[model samples]
Target chain A: MNTDTSRREEHWQRTRKLMFITLTIWFIFSFVVHWFAAPLNAMAPDFFGWPFGFYMAAQGSEIIFVVTLFWFVRAQHAIDKDCGFTEED
Target chain B: MAIIKGDFIDNLPKVYLMYTGGFLGFVLLMAIFEQMGMGSDTIGILFVAFTIAIYAGIGWLSRTMAVDAYYVAGRQVPAVFNGMATAADWMSGASFVAMAGGIYFGGHGYLAFVVGWTGGYILVASLMAPYLRKFGCYTVPDFIGTRYGGNLPRFLGVVILAVASFTYVTAQINATGTIASRALQIPFEVGVWFGLSGILLCSMLGGMRAVTWTQVAQYIVLIIAYLVPVIWMSNKQGFGMIPQLVYGDAVQRITELELLHGMGTLDPVAGAKAGLKALSVPFAAAGDSWQFVTLVFCMMTGTASLPHILMRYFTTPSVKAARQSVAWSLLFIFFLYFTAPALATFTKLQILDPNLATGIIGKSIADVQALDWIQKWSNVGFLQIIDANADGILQLNEFFMRGDIVVLATPEIAGLPYVISGLVAAGGMAAAMSTADGLLLAIANALSHDLYYKIIDPKADTKHRLLVARGLLLVIGAGAAIVASMKLTSILGAVAWAFDFAASGLFVPIVLGIWWKRANRQGAIAAMIGGFGVGTWYLYMIKWGGMDIWFGINDLRFAIIGMPVSLFLMVVVSLMTEEPDAETQAMVDEIRIPTGETVLKAAH
Candidate 1:
């Protein structure tokens, strides 16, 4: 009983942390990165011959989004396993 | 509220063929028009009678209509039929009329929109559908409120959904007016009136059943209407060839490419320094950078967020059906999508190819004039051209900024004739009308069902809810119609913003709340508030707050911010707050699995 309770609690803690990280990334991408579009555009190219501002707007947010979706799935799946949440259940 | 049970309406095939004589008349006329090289104004006189006949004459045949009849075709819609209906709901006039325009106008840059809209479905099917169906609510607000166990989040969602939808519906009305103005030889606003009336009648009379059936029919018209012209023009131009050649030296060197690119908002001459070959605008940059990235993000997420699209999922029989239906929608939509890029490529070549332009109209057929096909349309602001050096050679590079005209003008430019143009106009209006009415109805239903019935007047009777819904419809319909007439921004632009708000604000909370067992009331609330607040502020900044430069980018990034914050806040708040009770936790498990086979788990 104690082990199961501890496992559930641990799963809860992990989900909580993950959501924070994901959202923070989302917020930064949406507000901070977007808010700084002009400066980034004014800045020099980083990698891949793509301009910084242009790259951020064109592909960066999408990368984050793809990452966010996959991350959410992975995080949730881990918690589900920790809690013994099989589809069969 | 659950679907009201009915006998006859329950077993009706929601997607059964409705190829009546009246509707066929429309198809036939559209066919003739394509052969004749005509426009679409004739659709008004022809199909107006058919539309009215169906509404009044055929509508009277059904005496057993109920809320079940009105919404979800009594939830008896087969998955495949529902898929077709859903595709119609998804592919509006802006998409049909403007997608090719994006390709024509932006070259390779705007292809992101084509990919973004289609890709968004993967998320919708995976994340949103089955779970929402498991809860089985009448409207979005009900699901949000019930999930959160409060009215605040529901109200907030209602406001957001309303704002997003109003902005969207206005654009559809604008498209409707475009059809009327072009077809009927009247002001553009005249078309809006006809379009608005069609929407109002379909919505008020059919409820869900009427809308669903009409949408399916309209979708058929829209697709056929588009294909007839393209194929007909392609035939004369040569099978699978797009360049339209006439009998006599092709009377004029018709410049379609110049017309396509020249239609968008012109950038400052300084911004145009990249040369006439490039463009920079509110949604994209001159040289093509990251704006497309955000726009795609917003569009993809926005798809899941769009109220009209979500409303269709509720029509499914089960959660699994909802998921599967989305897959079907993607498949059906793929047909049009696959063709669109081809059309764009062909149209671009058809217009820009020096060989086609010069040979057909330039060399042999010189000094041609007098046809409403060319002159009148150019007069009314559909097509444009620039002979930069006045050397008689039209430059294809000039049309770098045209908005949504490729789909709008493709038929006419292809020489599909006036009647085909009329059908295309009707199809565009149908796309706009079907989706627009659904949106307006959603807002009204949220008000009537969520605000008035559930929140304010908790004990309200059935008739009162219906009355409120109908009343709100009238007010919302009129207001949105008026807003539609404004035409200050591009329809595609407004729709994208709505999708972004949905993606960043609503989709995260709604999907997680149902699927993720740990998602709690606090998390739902936090996610909604955080995402919606930031997303709104982001749009407000661009629309009203005036961040047109420096930090300026597309509205999609703003949405990207909101979605993450919302998801993050939801998690943090859920953890910090008290755990769910065992019963609530069990409900969460049930909402996810919904197979009724799993043993109940502890809520906390």
Candidate 2:
């Protein structure tokens, strides 16, 4: 019983850690990209007609969001598998 | 089993190809008519008829008899398709027509809409969606009522859901009315009634089942309608097909023009119409960071908490599918959102290009007034050409137009044929109607399921509940139609406030219920009252009390204050009170696990 409890605790801790890391990336991509967009646009040349900061804020972050979403899904699924918490079909 | 799943996946592509092929055939017919020199009015009517026929046909075919099917499509939707439906349900009129214009006028500062909305899905995917899916509930308030185990919490959930969704649906209906009036050539007041009838026809036919399939169909129309004119404008303007990457040059050019005119670069028109010159300053203006950040936070959190959006996840087959559907939703939504800023940039260039502007360096106001597109749109009151300096030639600052015009005028601005303009209008209508259907279902179901069945009459069977739900849909739809006809606020402004209220009122309890074991019924109730009450009172103060900023926060960004207060109160109250019953704690634990079994529904 004690071992079972410890296993559940360990599983939750790993889940929490994964969530923390992914959320940090989510923050940087979503918030940080917009926060520093002006400076970035100022220093950068027009790439494909967009200023660097403007491109990132308007376009690049959405791409990052897609990538981040898949990454989080894959990582969480992997964690669930390793922890034997995968939902039975 | 695997073979069956693989076969189903293979069928999806064929289905999409057939649908697209059919839609494109109609587009070809419209093009032929344009080639025949058909008038714009005829094309607009044709476009409206064609789009509505497709949606109404889909809604009719998907109509259902069983309550489960009506409420959630029998929970059989695959992840990618559910994602498409959710995207359609999410990209309302504001996103389809106004977002690009907002970006065009507000510049970098307006990226808050982009970041806030897409980022909210991250919260949904990680924190809310999968757990709620695991709980095996029908509505957002269903989860709240079930998780907290009470009538009052459930009732309060119904109130919050109704308030937020009603505000949101009214905005959608307003968008619909505007698009209908413009396309079909009717008064906005009568157009709202027309729009609401269409909304009721789609939703009342089959409930969520019809709504889901209709949204999927709407998604295709809206995406095609959005891309065609944009891609054409980009190619014509020498940006090639990849407008998303090449629009930066347009921005640089606009900035240069601003410099020549001695107007500051970045967001020259932000809040220009609102008479808030303080907010109309340049992008990343001083002391505006907090307000900007709070705006994004409010939108992001609000997106997660919205009942209509979260209800989309419940239609998916499993918790895993729920998470994957969110990713697909972002992908589907990204196509339009990513292009919106580019469209904004391209439209500005079209408006400002010397060849197009034509009233050269020393031209007369008469010359500027003779510009055909200007006369047409300005007559619609969407554009204002004030000769502020009494100079005959047009100055960049003299062109003050509502942001919505950027989208509505795009096809005309690009000199595209009238058929393309018709297509864009149809797409905007699809966006508004699809979202309105989902929102109306959410509001009606909350009253019928959460309030009526669960609290008022637990013994009510599925047939009785369905009847009540459909009746409530009519009442709420009519109520929203009345409000929409009033035109109290612009679509985006009303939408932003709806997001603020949902985020502030519901975000704390929803998040805490999943993560914190100590959260009790008392905590949930207190949090809702404290957060929603404070946030709403602040909005009232700002709007009617003639107050300007509350401790450096504006009314639009009140979620920043209300959310934290709600969280604090929930924690403090929960700590002071008795913990939840053991069964409730176990239910929370069960929810955290991703087991595929149907978890027992919360007992009354």
Best by lDDT: 2
Q: Give the distance in Å from residue B305's predicted Cα in candidate 2 to where it truly belongs.
A: 0.4
Tell me the deviation in Å of residue B63 in model 1.
Answer: 7.8
Candidate 2 lDDT tens digits, A1-89: 78756656777788788878878888887777667665676776566656777677677777888888988888888877876778754
Give the alpha-carbon lDDT of every model: 0.62, 0.82
**lDDT per residue as tens, model 1, A1-89:** 79855765665566557656755665566545655555675574333443455445444554555555555555555565656643331
Prediction 2 global C-alpha lDDT: 0.82
Q: Give candidate 1's TM-score.
A: 0.76
Per-residue lDDT tens digits for candidate 2, residues B468-578, read: 999999999999999999998888888888898898888988998999988999999999999988888888888888878677777678888788888989999999999
TM-score, per-candidate, Cα-based? 0.76, 0.94
* lDDT measured at residue B233 in model 1 versus the true structure, 0 to 100: 55
Least accurate 10 contiguous residues by lDDT in model 2 chain B: B275-284
